[model samples]
Structure formats: C-alpha cells, structure tokens
Target: MKNVLNDPVVNVKGIGEKLEQGLNSLGIYTVEDLLFYFPARYDVYEIKPLSELIHDDKVTIEGKVSSEPSLTFYGKRKSRLSFNLQVEHVTVKAVMFNRAFAKKQLQVGDMVTLTGKWDQHRLQITVSNYQKGRAKSDAKIQPIYALKSDVSNIQIKKAVTTALSQYQDDLQEILPEEYLSAYKLPGRLEAVKHMHFPDNHQVLKHARRRFTYEEFLLFQLKMQLLRKRKRESTFGNSQDYQAKDVEKFVEALPFQLTAAQSRSLNEVMTDMRSPYRMNRLLQGDVGSGKTAVAAIALYATITAGKQGALMVPTEILAEQHFQSLQELFADKASVVLLTGSVKGKRRKQVLQEIADKQADIIIGTHALIQEEVVFQDLGLVIVDEQHRFGVEQRRVLRDKGLHPDVLFMTATPIPRTLAITAFGDMDVSVIDEMPSGRKQVETYWVKENMLDRVLQFIQKEVDNGHQAYVVCPLIEESDKLDIQNAVELYQQLQEIYAPKTAVGLMHGRLPADEKEEVMRKFAANDIQVLVSTTVVEVGVNVPNASVMVIYDAERFGLSQLHQLRGRVGRGDAQSYCILVADPKGEVGKERMKIMTETTNGFELSEEDLKLRGPGDFFGKKQSGMPEFRVADMVHDYRALETARTDAQQILASGALDENPVFQKLAQYVYNDKIVKGETLD
Candidate 1:
C-alpha cells in the first residue's frame, strides 16, 4: 500500500479525466502531490445567532426562515434571491446573487445555516454557501483550497479526503524516532490527516510544525552533504596567495581600500590558498566596493598562472566590468569580454584567446556558459550578482575547470537568518563599510501631489552638472496596474525637461543593443535624465547620477528600493532619492518610512524579510533558492537552526546510511537538484 502515495491523481476515487487535467494544471500529478496541497485558508463555521453578527463581518449564522424566498431581477441578465430569517428575537435579511438553487431548498419557517459577510449599509447578509437545514451536529471548519481554472475548492476537498482515507495507513514516517522524541513532533500519517481535517486549531498547528520542520531538515541535510562532498573532493585547484603581490596590487590602486574591502579580500585570499575548495558568498551594500574586492581576487588568480572568469547578469554590466578590468589591469594581465553581441571574427578571436590561455581574465554575461567558451586552467569563478544565475548555470561554469574555487557576490544583502538557512553550506564575507568620501544618499518620501516639486529638484540636479534617474514600476501602461509606467513618464519628462535637459528611456522590453546604448549615453552625461524600470536596479553604475526619483515607489520591496537608491550617491557630490508615492496601506507606508530612515542594506533586508517573507524578498528563481513546501525562512528560523544541527549530527554519526527514510529524503533532494541542472555525483 506504500506505493499508493506515488499513484497518479487520476487513480483517486473522485478525480476523473477532466478533474485530473485541472489538477495537473495546479502541479498536482500524483497522489502525494494532492495530499501535500494544503489549504490556503480555512473557513471556520462557528455557528452564531443573527443578533451577534456585526456589519462587514464574515460569519456563519443559524436561523429559521421567516419568509418565502423571492427572486428579484435587476436587468435581463442579473437577478438575486432574497429572504428574511429569524434567530431567537432578532430578524435579518439574507441574499444570494445568481443562486437560484438556494431559492428552491429554502422555504418559509425552515431552519438553515449560512456563511457569508454581513453588510450594514444594505442590512443584508450576502450568503456564498448555505446548508438546507441546521446540522444534527455542530458546524465543522471547512478547507478553502487554492485552485486553477475549472477546479473548485469543493472538488479538491473531496479528492483530498478520498486520498487520505485510502493511503493514511500506508504513510511512512520520514523522521527518525529519536528526532520525533526530541522535537515532540507527531507521526507523518497523523500530521497529514490533521492538516487536512484537524479536530482543533492545536492539532492543525502541530501538523504544520511537523511538516515545516521536515522541509527544513531535508534542506539542511542536503546542504551539509554538499559541503562534505566539496571538502573531500580532490579535484579543486590549490593556488598560492603571495601577500607581497596582493599588497603591491592594492597599493597601486588609485584610491585607498576601505577596511571592510580589505577584510573581504583577505578572506578570499585565505580561501584561495586553502586545501578545500572555496564556495563563498560575498555580500555588500550597493557601492560597497565589492567589484574592487573581486578584482583583487582575480588578479591574485591570474598572477598564479591560473585563468579566471567573471559572469554578470546583463551585457551592460559585462561591458562595464570589461572596461574597468581593462583599465585596472592595464599593464598586468590580458583581459577580454565575450557577450552575445560580440560576433564573427571578434567572438571567435575571444574564444580562441580564452582556449589558448592568452586571455587571463574573462568577463561576460550568460554567454560565458556556452559550450564554445572554454577555459585554460580555469581556477577562479566569480559570479557577480549571484542571485541572478541559477544553481545549474553556476555549476556549468565551474565544471569548465576541475572544481574551480567559486565566489558568489551579490549587492542585495540578505538577512543573517536567511543567509544561514539559504547558504549554510557556503562561507560568507560581508563588506559593510563604505569607502571614504562616499556620502549616504539623502532619501525622502513624498506623495503624488508633490510631483512638481520632485520634478523641479531633478531639473535642478541636472543643472548642477549631475544626472538623474526617474524609475517607474511598469514599462508600458497597464490597465490592471494604475502605477506610473516608463513609456508614458519618458514622454512626460521629455516634454517637461526637454530643450533644457537630455532625457533617455530604458526598460527590459528594449533590445540588448538599445539598452546598452541608452545606458552608455546616460553614463557619458549625454543623457541628463534616464527614465527606466528596475533593470537599473542591479549593475548600471553612473557616478555622476545624483538624483533618483522612483514613481509608484510603494510597489517595490524594501531591498529593491534600497538597490534603486544605490544607483545614486556613487560620486563625490551629495545625492538625493525621492520616493513619489502615496502608499494607502499601513505596510506600504511603513516600507516607505524605512527607506527614508536608513541607508543600511542589511538592516533594510531584515526588515524586508520580516514584512514580505522570503518569497517576496526575492523570487525563488532569481535567488536560486528552492521553494519550500511548508518552511518559511523568516517564520521557521528556529526550526531551520534545529534542523541544521540535527542534520549535521545525523550525518556525523553515520546514521543516515542505515536509515531508509533518510536515504529516500536524500534521493528526493538529489532529484530536485538534478532537475534544476545542479551537478551531483
């Protein structure tokens, strides 16, 4: 019967071909998938009398029908059924729009239970679901599932109930008995049963806790195993770090290195010289000199007779890095850039140089991972804005060499808890200090009514020989979203600041060449103002751009807002970031206030995680993180810590080899990694 869990959803009792197709649309193909598809919310049907119902409150009420249901027609196509109900000494009106079936079951003096929201202005209860008569027992909590097209919550509930009844006895416990005792968790079968149909809120909470812990434990176990494999693997290149050479490189720089930058570089240097392969994450705020630290590491690798590769998210960033590296390594190493746009003779020449070991330092976008882009004795791989690349993409580049030391860098600072949970297997280095002469960008929150004032400030900043960026949430006008868009705003700004200031437009919809051109013009100060979307959030660096005005700023996450604000304040002049939005909700207002209060990326990241959870903080795809079924990086942080420790203990004790359940869990994680194109031996 254990095999029943893997049976297709079509084998379920109530799910037919049509229903199975709908379920497939929701990513539920197997019985196990159906069982794990937990309810998004529960509708508690606590019976209440009519007199206890409040205006605009959703409640379930039991009452006796006081009048016959009457059907009312608003127009030819619209009609509603209305009736009166009496509960104890109170009378209330009940209405069901387009529910003709409800009219037939209801009659005068018949007792019924209905669930809906009460409207005080209309003095009516708009019923969504109703029972023909009061139940013999108390009302039970109902599960409201997330659905796809043509699939109803009722259908999902029925299918899930059938699956639970048939497979409950066969459900195997994945957690070890000792772990269950230590954590005081319920068995797998009981947790799944209770999660779908809990007898009480306490049971539901226990079930949720068990599943969340399981997810975190499995993830931690996988991460620990990966770390073990990397440490024991003998394929990595071990390079020597010459302190004098690194010092010479640093001293020759145009500006002094910040303390934080020095510390991060030292960490990287130490990792490079270590026997074990280095898998490190370098995090810093925007403009925190992460590039300079990475440059030093690349220099060290090249100087050691090993080639290095740096992968960026966009071509514009790749070109920028290429130019910067060329200037930085003017007399030192051969530098080359390879992008999709570099074609024919140029592309072939670059590839030949790389394959021939002539190009010591290589920088490019996704084109770096193509088959033709081979490396000669590649020893170091630095992934800029690491979150932009998937785990498999990173693996592909690393596989180009015999286990090259990998360094992942990101400007989006993650919360400490998330960093531990998400990247627990990798070493972390943070550049928390800004370089000297860099001033914090002054930020302000303004309503839409202050648009003119914001525009005036942008104009004034441009007049002062500084550039400005006007960011919108959308590229084109969206009928569904009323936020300001780049296309329309570009036109408006051109008309408003035109003749006086040069305005440029950029968005993701633009072609690669066009985007590069616009950014080039903006950087060269040919365009005084650039109206664009969040594409500039990552790696478009213009030191002279001092003013950033983000329209519909409330639509962005705090971390994102911080990144956008980072585009400015890169030069010697004082900068300003104006958030033009009238956030109506408390959360949005709070997000706006946080942006105005601080420039610390880590603090803002923590707040963003708390406010929006890990999913919203960064898309799972963008972050290259696995989507957890039950565990949340923010809320289940305690569970994550315990799981990490227990996973380590289990692996260290060699108990995982003897446990079939642990083996199965490992297999599942491995399969997921394989699906994502991650390398596993």
Candidate 2:
C-alpha cells in the first residue's frame, strides 16, 4: 500500500557496511531483495513421536529432559553433551556433539525438542540441534541459503529475521484477493516467513507454491504483454500470403518434405496467412530441412506481392544459400545477394533492386542490417542461425520493412526449458523427424591408442573420392596441452595423406576470406581431407565429407559433438563420426557413450543441459530466462505452465490494464525488478 517495501538493506540490524557489500554482491540491495532470496534447498526433519521414530532416520522428537544434562569436554574445541529424554512414557538416550552451551539451559524437568537420527541399535538419538519448545529448532523444515565467500549464515539469518518483522505490514498482496482465496494461499508476509523458516513440511509446500506462482506469473505476464504489443502494432494483411502458392512451390521441390517439416511449414504458413504478423522460430537438427521450409515461406511472400529477406550469420553461409536458392527458384523469383563483398556499384545495384520491389528474396549476412539496405513491402524475414546475431541486429533488418513477419531458423535444437523462457516471445515450430531414406551416421567412440586406425580410415575414405573433416578443439600449439591443434593436425594429416589426398586447414583464428576459401575448396572436393576446428561446425554443407573425426571429443558438450556429427551425415552416402578421446572421468566417458549412441539433436541438447547445468549451457549473461527467486526452470516446469496459463487469463480479463494493484506490479515487471536480473527478451 505504501512505498516502504523498498527499504534499504542497511535498515536491518547487524548489517554493517562490509556485510552490506557482501549481501550486495549476492544481488540483495533492498530489504525486499533479502526477503525474496529463497533458499537453495531445505533440510527437512520430520517431527514424529518416539514410536514412529526409526533407526538411522533424521527426525525431530519432542520430549522432557528426564535426566540432568552431562557435559563432557572432548578434544580441542569439541565437547559432547549426553542426556536422556522422556517421550510418551519412554526414555531414550541423546548425545550431541559440540553443544556444551546447551548444558546450562537443560534442567531435569525441562521440556525440549531434539532433531537428528535415531540409532535404534545403540538405543541413542544422535541429536544435531536442541530447542526449548516443539518444532522450534533444527527446524522440522530448515532452509539452507546459498552464500558468498564473505557472508556467514548467522549474519544473513539475523538480518532476514529483523526484516521479516520490520516489514511485516508493508508486504501488501499483489495478487487480487479473490485469486489468493481461490488458490488457498497464505498472506505475502506469512509466505516469506514460512519460506525462510518453515514450521512443517505442509506449510513450506504451500509457501513454495505461492512464490513459484508469483515468480512464473510475472515472467509470463512479460511474455504475454510483448506478444500483445506486437499484435497491436498495426502490421496488417500485407504480411499474409496464400497457401496455394506455397503448396505449388513445395510441390516443385526436388525432394518431398518430411512429415515434421510439413507440420512446421503448416504452422508457419498459418501464422503468415493470419492478419497478425508472424513471429516464429523453426529449430531442428542440422540436416532436418529447415532451409527448404524457409524457402517455401519466402516463395509465398514473393507471390503475395511482397519481398522476402534471408539473413545468415556468415558470408560463406549467405553465399551458399544464395546459390542454392537461385538454383531452386530458377527464373520464378528474382533473387539477390548482398554482403560486404558486394561493394560500390554491385552493392548499389542490389540495393536498387531491393528498393524497386524487384528483389523477391534477398540473402546476406550481418551486412543486410546496414543502414543502406532498404526494402519495398518486405513481408517476411528469415534469419539463419539466429542466435549468432544480436537482438538489435534482427530488429534493424525488420525495421527496413513495415512490420515484416519474421521466421528465425536455427540448426541447434533448443531444449524445452530454454525454449519456453529464452524464446518465449515468439511461437516455436520444431522439425523433429528426419526425411525417409536418410542415412543414420554410424558413430564410434575410440581412445587415443586407436589414432592410427582412425587416420588410416580417413585416408581410405579420401582415397575412395570422399572428403573428410578432422576437427581439433584448439588452434595452435599451446604450452603443455596433450590434445591436437588445428595447425599441427593440418600439417600431420597432409604429410600422412600426401600426394594422393589434398588437405586444407581452417580454424576460428583464420581470416574470414581464408576460412571461406578453405571451406569452398572442401565443398568442391578439391580438398579431400580438411583438418579444421569447430569453425566448420557452422552449418557448412559439404555433402561429400563422409567422415568427421573429432579430436578430444570429451572436451566438447553433447550438443556440440552432435552438431559436429551432423556435418558428416548430410549426404546419401554412409557416414561416420569417430569420437577420438580417452575420457578419464565418468562424465567424459558418459558423454562419449551418449554421442556414439544417438544422433538426435534434441536428445543431446537436453543431455547437454543436464551435464553442463543451465549456466554453462547458456552463458549466465546471455541466458534470456528471467532470474527467479524460488522457481526452478528444470524442476518447477508444471508450476511454470500454470503461471503461464494464469497470466493469459489475467491478460484476457484486462486486469493488468484496469486493476490498480496489477498496474503497479506491471510497472515492476516493466522495470525488470520483479524477477531481478535477466531481461525478458
């Protein structure tokens, strides 16, 4: 009701300057921030009677101190307190380590609670904590907060204890009273108190339910509002295209669309044909035909009397798509290529074609977003490898046209948790199934001892007129590394394959022109063996490259290894992905085993998310998911869905725009403070 919820952390007792700095490092600046900083996990000790207590079970029991507490000093800084407690006409021996301070507090008749494990064999309860009353200490449900190096548990608990009381009246309910009643949720203050220190498991569950809902609701509101704003932004039917043209274009393709591709295309075409502008993402494995689907969408845009723009991450990819599309469309649609290479007169000619409504589909790299590029009635925008480009870069290209329907295409299939959060603003379409008659890449995990055999195998493949890629993780010789480098591998492979096989070298450190040239040579089969790094992992289609040998494969994530594997299995020829590494750890061994077992990108991406954790999977700064206090992206998925549904209901009810409390909460969401750090985008 008041602005007092923004009380500074210094207002809390015991939070001095140094301590405040420590808390600040953990992103706690306000009293509210400290209040909402939920525990990483909870230590639950079920409070039970002596009868229900089992052997070696961590539990809490309420009883009387029937025997005087005996304190015995042990080794340095250690003491053991032994006592007997009377519970339901039964006396059980209790021993606690390093709790000599409680010796003075316990009398012969004092009622107390001890929480720990009951060792029935020895007839003793190994107590971890003792309290004056029932369910008071060692918390039947205790919270374990994540801490920084400088902060201590006592310091945070003390400050949080003070803030919990001082701001008790200030936590006005943001959710409407009716919904809270319907959900049987506790008051805001009660929930926060129970979250930090719960009396029992049932109360903690209810508290967690409340916070999880609130956290997800704020994020889903942001997502819903973004879509609503786009729909209301007035890009009308000009973005729409008839399905008949798209059908004819698809019918003309050399190969038929897979069922998954057809499903994805139908979803995209439905969005395109709507009065509202389309905003969708088509994500699939590397060779799942996302390009062909995009091509059909582009052709639809052209036939609808509007232009299409296909933006890629690299110049080489742009050139490849330009050539492929030019051949695919033939004389039906005028296609143009614009990149940094197209300079002076050539750039001017392409720009004029785009401006005069002559270029039906324009393909280029980041150069397409330059201020000089403009389009006449640009209706559809297809971005390849969309993650490689910045949000602003995509926006720049879209701005050149009056509200173009955008389709972002990525070869890397996103895990569902990431898809729901990172790309929440746009609708998603996934092509999960590969085309029929496609060759499944034969994958193998081999150790370093088998290097010679792998090399000989690559040479044998090259001798059969097929190209092979030898990928190293590093660029050059580093101080004391044991793994292969691109340059050394390039040289050694060249020396080994000699005279009979031509080898090319490519890595991230190579100049753009040099890498592109090497890639071109490999694609043309001029180079039978390409000793390169993961730079070749960026959707390079050299169908003739039938073998992919990943050096130090254990060093890469499952998703990256799968992407590397996808590069080789694109053609009709039988392909092989050899993971060359001697994995020393269980995780490394597991990664290699998984890579050898499955070629599904989605499955591998999920495994990657679990193995690497979400932070390393998507760099902390780049993860688009909002920072949540209590809701977990991985485990609290059902809560997230409920919140999303509730958010839509709230939006449809006009509560966000009309209700006073919701309006204030909406401002918090707009300022990115509701969930703290991550941007909703």
| Clash totals, every prediction | 0, 0
Q: Which ten residues in a row have the lowest lDDT in candidate 2?
A: 672-681
Give the whole-model CA lDDT for all candidates, comma-separated. 0.85, 0.82
Which tens-of-lDDT digit does each residue in 1-681 have in candidate 2?
456768779888778999989999998999888998888888665577667767787777888889988988968999989999988888889999998888888898888878788897876889877778666434355677899869877778788898878878787777777768888888788899999988888889899888887888888888777877666664565455666777777888899999999999889888887888787888998878899999998999887889988988777778889999999999989999998888888889999998898889999987776898877788888887644546676566556545778888888878877787777677899999887888899999998899999988988888787889889899988887777898988888778878888989888888888887888788889988888888787846888889999999988888888878888977778999999988888999988988878888999888888777666656677746567777777678787777788888988998877888686666666666423334322
Residue 40 CA error for candidate 2 (Å)? 4.1
Cα deviation at 668, candidate 2, in Å, is 4.9
lDDT tens per residue, model 1, 568-613: 9988899999999898889999999999999999999999999988
Model 2: lDDT to the true structure: 0.82
Error of 1 at 193 (Å): 1.9
Supply candidate 2's per-residue lDDT for 154.
71
lDDT accuracy of residue 120 in candidate 2:
77
Judge candidate 1 against the unseen true structure and give its global Cα lDDT, from 0 to 1.
0.85
